[model samples]
Target: MFGLKESEIATLITAVSVEGGGDLDRVSIENRFARATWSGLAEPGDRLAGRAIQQLGAARALSAVVEHWNTERFAAELSADGDPVAGDDMRQAIDRWMPRLKSDTALIALRQAARFGARLLIPDDELWPERLNDLDWHAPSALWVRGTDAALAGIVDGIALVGARAATGYGEHITMEASAGLVDRGYTIVSGAAYGIDGMAHRAALASHGLTVAFLAGGVDRFYPSGHDSLLTRIVENGAVISELPCGSPPTKWRFLQRNRLIAAASLATIVLEAGWRSGSLNTAGHAAALGRPLGAVPGPVTSAASAGCHRLIRDYDAVCVTNPDQMAELAPLVEREIDVSEIDSELRISSATPGSEVSAENVDTVGARSPETTRLIDALSARSARTADDIAARSGLAITAVRAHLGLLELDGRVTETGRGWKRVAVAKPETSRVFRSPSTDSE
Candidate 1:
């Protein structure tokens, strides 16, 4: 159907499905091939395409698009089947998807990806991160993965560490410590494979003999940030380098922003090591917070401009001020069971024996250790005037339920008080404390 012989199509499907460890029937093969076509045909996070595929199966959706049905006809077909897309939205989607429609593009992409030893991972695949399904319509149609299946499995328990590409020496050092510590505690590290903090995180995890996955904005075949070529190569050897795009696709600004969603969704938590006021890492943090995943940020010197983004996250976004591996580890749920008794004892010895192994709770409370929702509620509150829950919801962009929950936490923290009118931010002195450092090395950084 895509200008390839039936035998060739079967071979391609087999290659992609082999790693998934599934027996594919003829129907399954065609569906898998259709999804590959959709991957190349649509941009990442294309809601129109996602909706169509969800309503009609991938194979049927591709047929509907390829048949050149007019907007009115397509809309009527969808509406008859109880789909919500119609009129201008349908026409716009058809117009956008038409130009990329090619009979042989999917076949070519599949062959190219296979040549580079990449596997096509669909939602049904065993190694697929089920967590990504949480993204709903924004989830990828298919993933181009390069590396061990075992490495891909690590993603379910992974934590994303990301920050500014132009990170300072301080940022690199903290990321190094955090990455290594997490690795020692048996958690996989995930990052964007960008320069600076991202690069250091991967390198440290690798040095610690830990599995680390790198999510790329472009195709898995071509690593972005050309300077990280060797590093990415090593990652593919021990960890996986993955992308939602097909081979030969290039990274763009929009894709980078969209890519952050995958890193956040795939991991159990996301940590910002260092960032400026407008660092792209904040976008990652936003996605994590919105997804209800735990988010963390490392505190930098109050004077260092590089740490401003991290500080902003703590002050405004309710990010936990994670200073050491232990604090960072706390962000992940079910992590306590993952640690070995021996490892816990070893960590305690190191924390007690080492001069600066632990950062006190007071040190970590510079921005207040409330949940992100609490921080948002506090930000929405007025110091002098009481505001109702509905008023707080409108201002904080939180749902009424979330606002109430956060208000309860804030009230318990003594940071807010309820009045006849509503709630008011309580004026209180934040205690003074020293910055927490994990060790002498981190202190120097």
Candidate 2:
């Protein structure tokens, strides 16, 4: 752990992710290096390939062993010729695959975090959530933590609340109530820190002066959806904003989906207040179900599109249906506790607003280089599938020229790519059906 601050560790792992030298892919390599380093089996100077072989000598964790394999032609040539070093073929393979992570981006990012008072949390650490290991190789290398230890203390006793970005009135109400209730019951609320449900959950938790954690898809220092930057800052003041990615990492679509798994696994349970059939919240729920953890959804009206995902979970996936705080707590097997709601709400209102109009992708990047229109377009696109120039304009409520201009910017950024006729969000989920209102069938949206 020496000389390996959270950022340095991230850079080192990124260095190991060089691909195509052997059979190893960047993702697998990052996973292997993370496991080995945190397990105290590897150090910065040790020949990574050799350490990988040594770490896998037991053949116990097959996934770890398989990751270190090398498909280099040189190694194969040696093996085919019956070389003496064939006994150490795995080590030979590791050497053959050593040239991948020569880039300095990872290291630079690490330096930034160190300068910012941020720390990294790994699986073996006391703060690490054992549940995250359920993700196998897909689990994060380490969590970039920005906040007090208390924010992460009750991770095992937390619950995640996630839903649509353009949340309905009912959805917001449910998120606020659920967050407040859970906190009042002494449970930490974990969320993505996006707009709508995610924002409401964090705000409510803060209002109650309760522990809350925000798991970002980007770096600990980089808040995605720039609109929530201030909100995230507030959370980090008392709670935390964490990510598996290194500091200065951007919020790519793939990272968001990948991070959702962490949110689901880190908590004792997950709740969806409002989501459409294709919402990313479902992705988190899927991770929870795969881990065999208790899954819960607030039943929205069957007619309301935003409720589609929640309804699907209840009907098809057998998620526990909860309507209110009592029902939600019952699913978690908890006893009731009293709290001063007025004090928490009052404090939250006073501390919540920080003079930001909205959060957009322009500010989401660690670089803060994307424009506000580009952020708006991405936001609108993120809420739905491939949209035509006209469709984007209509849905985003922006001028046609503005939509076209933003779309062009997004395409150039590689955040979005053209899909056949129009354009589609790259590496991100298709947008969910928009919900204008909540129906009466469900008590709350």
The TM-score leader among the candidates is 1
Best-performing candidate as measured by lDDT: 1
Candidate 2 lDDT (Cα, 0 to 1):
0.60
**How many clashes (backbone atoms < 3 Å, residues ≥3 apart in a chain or on different chains) does model 2 have?**
6
Q: lDDT of each model, Cα atoms only?
A: 0.76, 0.60
Q: After aligning candidate 2 to the native by TM-score, how far in Å is the CA of 427 from where it should be? A: 15
Error of 2 at 337 (Å): 17
lDDT of 1 by residue, 49-153 (tens): 777777677888888888888888777766765655658877767755665677777888888887888888888778889888888878888898998877898
- Candidate 1 lDDT at 188 equals 92
lDDT of 1: 0.76
Model 2, C-alpha of 78: deviation from truth (Å): 18
lDDT of model 2 at residue 111?
61
Q: For residue 437, give model 2's deviation from the true position in Å.
A: 18
- The C-alpha RMSD of each candidate to the native structure, in angstroms, is 15.4, 15.6
My TM-score estimates for the predictions, one after another, are 0.74, 0.60
